[model samples]
Target: MRIRKVIPGDARPARSAPGGEEAARDPQFVEAIARGFTILEAFTTRDSMLGNQEIAERSGLPRPTISRLTHTLTRLGYLEYLPRFAKYQLGIAAVALGQLALANMAVRGVARPLMEALSQRLGASVSLGRRDRLSMLYVEHAQPASAVALQLGLGSRLPLAVTAMGRAYYAVAQAEERAAIDQQIEERFPERWARVRDALHEAVDMHAALGFTISIGDWNREVHAAGAAIILPDGGIAAFNCGAPAFMLDRDRVLREAGPGVSEMARRVLSIASGKG
Candidate 1:
């Protein structure tokens, strides 16, 4: 498989000074800008809303730093303010940027029509994502006729170890790349790594056998997910997944049906991505 060169803003290791040196490395708020993004990254698949104090505590940035960054982010339209509740949430501009990126991505166009068809057939939500360093970035997502559906917006980042989409992509990555991604995860999110590290071998075997991976509440409780990779022309992979609330999707039926459908759709999307379609 070919490794592509980095495009601007493609996720990479957050280069601060080696471990304890971060606070002492910069005189200006270069560290502050880094801290601001760190605070932003603290919001994730599990946690949505956070108070200033919560952000301060989570990011390890001072309370004043968190406050200034939150205020600036809110004013810049990247965050929303809830004055009464003293909480902050992602704002419209964040969603808009995500939508714009999805609109422009070549992989998204090739995967969209197929995802829609798959969603209709399975009556569940379908999602497409790519590995950005150790994270899975949502690139395309579709929902089926069921009353409730996962509403992950484009550009949302999910952990790559516990989630099916993450595992599928991880399985396709080259050994060195996989190790690097894993190392980054271990360093960045140690607690999460402890949970999924031992499961890697099993996940790899599952991908080799099924041509995809299935996750049940590994990332989100009561959420069931199945994922496969669209192999590009160069033998690289782009990841995609389908998710449904456990109550709506029978686990056995998904394993029997959705698994194959997602695998087949991924192959088709790969063909299209490679210009073979």
Candidate 2:
């Protein structure tokens, strides 16, 4: 069977510059590099290995283009060709790049202790995340020593529409940025927008009113989470989230107990991040 094409409409909007007129006007933009990255991103946890045809379908590129790009990437050590399966998987270079990126982020070092302490105190999983395109990318994570926690790790990504971390980040974003993201979400997930739109607005309002947001089974049916955002001394915005299994943290408890605690923790973290603590 032919692999389903992963068209632009099937995925989140590009976090980079807008396409069409905006892209055409940018003379310094490199389309080849962007296309190469797109091809690399076609391999996922579920789709770990892909042939040139599958990569072409998933990246919305022509087969010939994918063939050339894949070969180039393989030569650069960004992808490894699997002879047995006749497919390609991420290479050690990708892991090295990701590790280097994480190693250089100062905020992760600054937030690790606080996240550890918070997770220990609350018996929940604590995560630090930043905006990656339209999703929240986990940069650092901590879990209680003795508790069973969510199996999230560095580089894990959650949706911007329903995750508490995503909402918290959105709430703190500038008006124009938020508007652009909102428009993109509406366009990307039109079928689900009506159901999620009102809840998203409510989350933003809650964050504005209470310094944090709560999500109970909104993103995942088995999880409950709360989040708040902080602006680092370097002016980068990041969100911290605490989450637990739905069986362990019900909706009322999240709103009544975890919500306030997470909010206060966020404020303290923000103070530390801003060098005011």
lDDT of candidates 1 onward, in order: 0.75, 0.79
The TM-score values for the models, in the order shown, are 0.74, 0.84
Off by over 4 Å in 2: 1-29, 45-47
Clashing pairs in 1: none
Instruction: Please provide, for model 1 over 57-125, each residue's C-alpha lDDT reduced to its tens digit, 9 standing for 90 to 100.
Output: 676777787788999999988889888887988889877876776666787788889999999888777
Which tens-of-lDDT digit does each residue in 148-245 have in candidate 2?
A: 66766666778877888988998888888888887777777788878777877888899989888988888778889898887777778879888888
lDDT of candidate 1? Answer: 0.75
Candidate 1 residue-wise lDDT at 2: 29
**Largest TM-score belongs to which candidate?**
2
Worst 10 residues of 2 by lDDT: 1-10
